[model samples]
Target: MEKPPSYGDSNELEQPGDDRALPPATLYVAGRFVHSDDPQAPPLYELSHSVGFLSDNDRVVRLERLDYTVRQYQGTPQVSTRARHVYDLTHPTLATSPTFAYHAEATSRRSLCSFGMESFRARTLSSAKGYRVHRAARGPDHRLVGREELFTAVPARDEAVVFEWYDARGGLLARETDNGELLSLLVSAEMGPRERDALVAAWILRVWWEMARDKGLGRWDDGAECP
Candidate 1:
């Protein structure tokens, strides 16, 4: 089977300080990384980072080596996923700080995106960039009931992106955004399935305007984890 894109390598990405300056900060990605002496490479844990805000905001997230960035806009009617360019950073997780931040390229891929740090919100409102889940009815015969929703008021990180699930049985399937606006759910169906997690930000965000139209859902299986 083909591999899927992931944020496992991203959460640990942070800015690196000067070589002649102070020691870099330490980072922990639940399991993938631990503090180490080597500035070139930090310790790797399991390699799976749960997105808190990205899945909730549906924004674009980019991880460039030791640098990680998320993008969002203001006053724009169109709500979109921010984008990131893949670059080789001299400083690795072993040599970077946890609170450090760097540059981000939002419209590099397209022309409509505006770059900025993303903030996760707790509730979804009538604002310009808000997400909501609708549940009508399954009609004649639809299995599994309804879909789920991950709502956010601010749509950033550290906030509550209310994840609500609604199935036919009214089980209220659990859905939520992790640390970044990352979305996820345990969906079981015989039709097309979601291959990657919400950590697959760009692919899922870039083409969502047309509802994926002729374009595929966008996958990282094409090449190295650059995209």
Candidate 2:
């Protein structure tokens, strides 16, 4: 029931909220076989171009103390539903009412929203991944704050797209990936929430902070620390 202490040690944990400054969080997209809500189809796949939109597959539960449960989703196309939920191990009551709000869409080419993206922009920029940047879309009109950059990316094996947000430090501020594989493996054939397919993004600017604390070596644990 308890989350294994990250990777290395708990003492390395950064102060609350310190994660906001870290960059480039790595994302692993997989299906949601354990919680599929569909009556006939449960996610089941190992690798595929399956993912939900950023605005339709995500959820947020902000704690009263200013922390949060920021869960993003990732998956395969047929099972475009997955999630990443943040939890303050010390205080979990925060899951009740989230102060911040956002979502993503799974049916339409891995679309996304919030965390500084719009339905319009997300749809218009679905070709960011495998394709080279040809015609640049309109700039600086999204809802993101500070020196953040929105990137459209995709992994091999699927025809869908993924979204990522970055801060000035090149840290992966956030991400939204949906998986089609796990959706096929659901114990019960069922779909999740209405916005489930489209709402799977993550705010992880603090990924480094979490990793630093996790690996028990602040900053130094970064790849730069080795190479």
Candidate 3:
């Protein structure tokens, strides 16, 4: 398969820096982000227990077990045996630090993402952009795709641009904006299955992380961690 440069190799992306250097959390994108060939509307996917079209009542991918563990399913709304992830928490025997584990049958893939106390340093960035730091992977080897970053948020607005994800080359892979009701996702192109699934999983993590922060559920001396 054709490969993209990893985030480490990409020279264009700005490294995280002082919180003051970052833009305000309520910054907004001007217009629609969806492309001509996008899956649904201009803002492609709708946010819900299942990522699909709310307008048409279409259910594509179902996310099972939204608490600590998340399972991504493709077709019917059912449990997924392919991709399983443990986000922001771990089993009793595992480490306390927030991490991600992709489990498939007998084999184990390297974590698709991870979060730690240091991840919450940037107060302006969203949890997906700030806390979950890792790459999207494909296949049994879990080969990584360039870099992944989702940051910025538009706070306290009825309709606001939240965060966006980019490829290693600085191309927009996905952007999510939210209204009072639901989050609308916009994508640049027809992405691969793994890439699409990874984006959805990242969104779920973002939502949970914010819930933990808003409720003061899992907080540390420095910042918040999802419960």
Candidate 4:
């Protein structure tokens, strides 16, 4: 599999700084279902692209138009809007903090979930929990049933991100690692087809958002404007 781009170096892309703020750029991250060349593997959907929001000065402050591809029971392909999340950089978590609020909305009935994060840390945690699954509904009052915890975000000695997904009973479901750019996920047989698809979607969204957040923070730390 091809590795995604890294966000560490500002020289690769236009650097965003207070003195020389760049125009907003729309970068896209794609997620696709993977399988073997052999016919034995289940059919997968095509890659889906979603946009992450950047400020006028090119700082990521929100994520929008998140879409996921899913297959119907009749084997038809469908694209569904997952959720939109807005983040408050100054006080991303605390309600009383200046410009501190996190909000999310579901874009379609096909999306079985919606979420809100108190902060960036909480956003990471929620991503780790597979976006907090909920009953598919048209409104925001849906009840959350369960979630998937893939791994801890803490960096290892090698600076690699280790991941492990487990079921509610504590059975291991999947594992993978992210070393800078490349990220791989190994799904267990115990997971159902629906669950495997959901996990893959959540994993992709989380990774992309984190990268955008890192890039934005890098710019902000270098003295870019904030909300």
Please provide the root mean square deviation of candidate 2 (C-alpha atoms, Å): 19.8
The residue-by-residue lDDT of candidate 4 on 1-227, one tens digit each, is: 42222222213322122123222221112223332223343323333232222222322232232334476756877655443221111113333342212222333222223333222222443443232222221223332222333322222223343545544455655555543333455554443333443454444444444544565322112121111
Count: clashes, candidate 4: 2
| Model 2 segments more than 4 A misplaced | 1-118, 123-161, 168-175, 181-227
TM-score of each: 0.19, 0.22, 0.38, 0.38
Q: lDDT per residue, candidate 2, 51-93, as tens digits?
A: 2211121232221111224354564333233332222111112
User: All candidates' lDDT scores?
Assistant: 0.25, 0.25, 0.33, 0.33
Q: In model 1, which regions exceed 4 Å deviation? A: 1-159, 186-227
Q: Pairing residues by index, what is the TM-score of model 3?
A: 0.38
Candidate 1, residue 191: the lDDT equals 16
Candidate 3, which segments miss by more than 4 Å at Cα? 1-95, 98-132, 136-159, 216-227
What 10-residue stretch in candidate 4 is worst by lDDT?
218-227
* Poorest lDDT segment (10 consecutive residues) of candidate 2: 218-227
lDDT of 2 at 153: 24
Report, for all candidates in order, the number of backbone clashes: 34, 67, 3, 2
